[model samples]
Target: MVLLDGLADEGSETVVKPVRFRIGREGVAESVGVDVGWFTARGYGELEPDGLLRLSPVEALYLTKYGRVAVEDDSGHVMGFEELFSRLAEKTANLWRDYVIYMDLRNRRYVVKEGFSPHLRFRVFERGTYPESAAKYLIIPVYEGDDVVVEELLEYVRACRAMNKTAVVAVVDRRNEIVYYTVSLVNLINP
Candidate 1:
């Protein structure tokens, strides 16, 4: 894993000076003067044209969870993880489910980005081939016990095929563990 500047090991323990980010009035977190080279080069967040690193809710949550960034409230008080969690969680449909899958993928070293549509939760690039290569898989998040519609699954598979990518459904169970299934369409001609 690529360690951010302060997350590196210092002698016996890892010293982390979390980069500070202020939650905008719009609820999006923005950090200025951060190590743009470190973040943008690693695909953590978008480096806006105005030069701010604007983190998505999940990105902010992920960084905060690992103590890589500190999120502050409007009054300038730094929020604890739970506070940040509750705030950020309200912004997305299923925060815990998405974060679990995102963290799992990141731990596997895959470059992941938010997918184009709501049903397609994330676009995962091949390990070490981000920015240079197109995404290899479109991940659709499925919570365990949630009804799975066959037509929806077929649509996801067709969409992946149209983009020359594979459709991977990440099932997040009650335990928060994930299992991935590759969905595809196959035709068997009569002999």
Candidate 2:
């Protein structure tokens, strides 16, 4: 409640130290509008959800790292980064790798939107830009240890091309480090 109010008046980058939120029975919390406005406008969340906007654990953790919100688990305890990541990783095996890419992009000041279909992680825009415009690139993260086939790489490129965006592969190493590569299947010229 208070967190939502604070986020309403503030920018997303403003650190809201220990912002309070509780995980509900449905796993979605009542803490809508806190990070959604800035995140969505920058293209992270949907414009709206069924009722209150539901945040994924990754989103919550991202905000928390920036001092945006602090989430309370069902046990009425604050979730530390490790616990939160462990809980969320149960559902997604590549959670940590994806998080590494997410953090890298965020640190670079890209407005990163979590990807939906086509097996991508983020649709990225230049800083201070809105999502209504075309995203500059679509990032599909792959762990360095994962053996990537040529077909899968081509598919990612095709998908981004279809969407009129460039394809970027964020190759994450075991140390949680990242290296970005741009892939293209067509010949294009610089303006």
Query: What pairs collide in candidate 2?
Result: none
Clashes of 2: 0
Question: Each model's C-alpha lDDT?
Answer: 0.83, 0.68
Mark the 10 consecutive residues where model 2 has the least summed lDDT: 1-10
Clashes of each: 0, 0
Tens-digit lDDT string for candidate 1 (44-111): 87777888888877888888887878989889899877898799777677988888999999888888
Candidate 2, after superposition: displacement of residue 141 in Å? 1.1
Cα error of candidate 1 at position 163, Å: 1.4
CA deviation > 4 Å runs, candidate 1? 1-13
Q: Relative to the unseen true structure, what is the C-alpha lDDT of residue 5 in candidate 2, on a scale of 0 to 100?
A: 39
Candidate 2, which segments miss by more than 4 Å at Cα? Answer: 1-4, 7-15, 24-44, 47-51, 187-191
